[model samples]
Target: MTAKAKYQEVLDLGASLNIQNGDVKEENGTLKVWGTANTPYEKNLIWDKIKAIGGESPSDIMADIKVADNSVYHRHTVKSGETLGKIAIQYYGKASKYQDIFKANSDILKNPDVIHPDQELIIPNA
Candidate 1:
C-alpha cells in the first residue's frame, strides 16, 4: 500500500475502537466533553492495547471528557517528494494552510520542513 493509504488505514483502525463519544458541550466557543467513563482501569487497558498497535490517543484520555469523532480527519504519511505545503493544498485546497496541517499533527511532525516516509499526519478541514 502507499504510505498515505497506510497512514489512513491506521487511523481507520483507531476510529473503530470505542474510544471517544462525541458529546461535547460548547461554552464560550470552547467545546468540552460532558462525561467520562467511571472505570478508568478498563479504559486504560483499552487505550494501552490501541497504543501497542501504533495507534494514537484521540485526546487527553485521562480528562473527564467524552471522545471526539475523528473519522473525517485525514491521516497522511510523508512520501518522498511530498511537502507540507503540498499536503495542505492537496487536502485543504490552500498551501498556506500547511500550518493547520502541521498543528493538527504535531505529535508526529517534529519539524514542518522535515518529514519521513510512513510518518502519519492529521489533515484537518479548513
Candidate 2:
C-alpha cells in the first residue's frame, strides 16, 4: 500500500481530534505528519494510534505531534455516573489517584465524592 493510504487512519484521527497546524506529506514512501494537540493526553492518543497501526518502530510513517498545554495532562468534562476514581483509572491506571484529581480541582470541587455532571476538572499529570 502507498504510505499515505497505510496511515489514513492516523489522518482521520487527527481530524477527529481537531488538531491544529496539521500538515501531511508523502515522500519516497514515507508518510510525514505534523500537528499540535491540545494536551499531552491528546498527543498520546495520536501516538498510540500511530504505533498501533505501524508497530513499535515502523519506518514508513513519521509524526511530529506537539502538545499545546503542559500545565495539566488533560481537562476532563465529567459525565453522568462517572467518579473521579474511574476517571483516574482511565488516565493513571489507579483509583487512589482520584485524590490528586480532586485536589487539582479543589477550587471547584468542595467534596471529592460530590461531583456532578458537566464539571470540567483538571487531570494532573501522573
Query: After superposition, which runs of candidate 1 have C-alpha atoms over 4 Å from their true positions?
Result: 1-72
Q: Go through the candidates in order and give the clash count of each.
A: 2, 0
Error of 2 at 21 (Å): 0.4
TM for candidate 2 is 0.96
Tens digits of lDDT, candidate 2, 1-126: 898888898899999989999999999999999999999999998999999999999999989999999899999999999999999999998999999999999999999999999999999988
All candidates: TM-score: 0.43, 0.96
On residues 51-84, what C-alpha lDDT tens digit does candidate 1 reach at each position? 4544575332222433343343455668988999
Question: Model 2, stretches more than 4 Å misplaced?
Answer: none
Which residue pairs in candidate 1 have backbone atoms (N, alpha carbon, C) closer than 3 angstroms, thus clashing? 20-67, 21-67
lDDT of 2: 0.94
